[model samples]
Target: MTEGSLPRLELWCELQCPDCRTALDDVRALRERYGDALPIVLRHFPLEKHKHAYAAAEAAEEAFVQGRGWPFVEAVLARVTELERRGPELLVEVAGELGLDAEEVELALIDGRHTLAVDADQAEGKAIGVSGTPTYVVAGQRLDGGKSQQGLRERIVALLEG
Candidate 1:
């Protein structure tokens, strides 16, 4: 790898965390600014505190299979306030809004089809000091700047310039 290149950048986040929701906007801004030059990988770290988070994570993976991972993520995060009240059903509604198969999403949520993947991601996050939402990892550096878009952009640029 060359010095002037962005190392792997991953956003360890949960769908139900308010901090993660705010960070999501920052991530989207960075993605838009860099395009493929900075692909933000989303890792599920559904804090056990948020009851609806795990199911939302599973729905995200299902959406990924249907080629709508980030959109699904954005939609759910957009409804960041309604997460606890509606639980997994909120994901179904978000899917419907995106013209995705709402029933399929609901069924996947019911069966917990993507539970293992979500769990694995959580475990991986924990292994790397990611016990919170909005943890961004860049080139082996773990950053928990939350909603600090400037900090994230600097880190990403530094990695790419390394």
Candidate 2:
């Protein structure tokens, strides 16, 4: 796809904690505000400190394989606190909430079937200098910080107009 056809915003985040969820909320609002005019791609960048982050990322990739990536992501974000508190069971619950087959998601997590894809996301983020959660790449401009709705909207508008 050409530059104009590509997504206007791409977010690199981890779903293992509540901070990422907060960031995702802003992303969701931006999408609602811009509609199809702004595209946001979610990439997994699970941190090493979060015990279940890697597994959660694997589950998300499995969901992607099952064509439920976005839903899986939303589920994860919705239960970030639960995931941090209760762990993988929360991830499974989120999968079930998204109508994903729990057994398959579990299998994917156990089998390491999607580990490479998740790792690749992390590698790409590192390559692009993402050393933290909630990093955003907007029209080739990288913004590393927790951005509020107004802040994000302003940057996106500037990118679109520039």
Candidate 3:
């Protein structure tokens, strides 16, 4: 967050949360506006209430390792209901649809290779006072967008411009 350092946005999110899915709109808009100027990083913050959220987070990490992180996230977020209905199977299905190795995604989930990374993100998120999904940290500020995303994009813009 230093002055003249490249500004980054950390999105603490649960893949299964509906609010997090909605937050993707702002994420997409930011990507469209800033392109590579701004880096929007996704951090896992899977809430315990969501049954499949932890698995989804692990799957996302695997997708990231496979070089299709954002697209996999977007695709998974776009089908939250299906994810809730189908769990790990839905994760594998989405990976195949995106041309990723479906078997590898499944194995990663089962072997727990990405669990440590997801857990670390969750722990870091809690230490940073992230209490809910879709929370954003940018320019040393934490913006909670769980209930509303109003003025968030503007605030980020101001921080980036300031």
For TM-score, the strongest prediction is: 3
Best by lDDT: 3
lDDT string for model 2 (1-162, tens) is 465554568788888756676777677777787778677787888899999898898988888888998878878878777787888788778888788898899888778888888889999999999987888888788877554434765776677557
lDDT of each: 0.83, 0.79, 0.90
- Higher lDDT: candidate 1 or 3? 3
Report backbone clashes per prediction: 0, 0, 0
Tens-digit lDDT track for model 1 on 1-162?
A: 555445667988889888777777667777787778775788999988899889999999999988899999988888878988998878999998898888999999888789899989998998988878888888788888565545676766676567
CA displacement after TM-score superposition, residue 106 of candidate 3 (Å) = 0.3
Per-candidate TM-scores read: 0.91, 0.86, 0.95
- TM-score-wise, the better of 1 and 3 is 3
Candidate 2 regions with alpha-carbon error over 4 angstroms: 1-7, 147-150
- Candidate 3: count of backbone clashes, pairs at least 3 residues apart or interchain: 0
Candidate 2 lowest-lDDT run of ten: 145-154
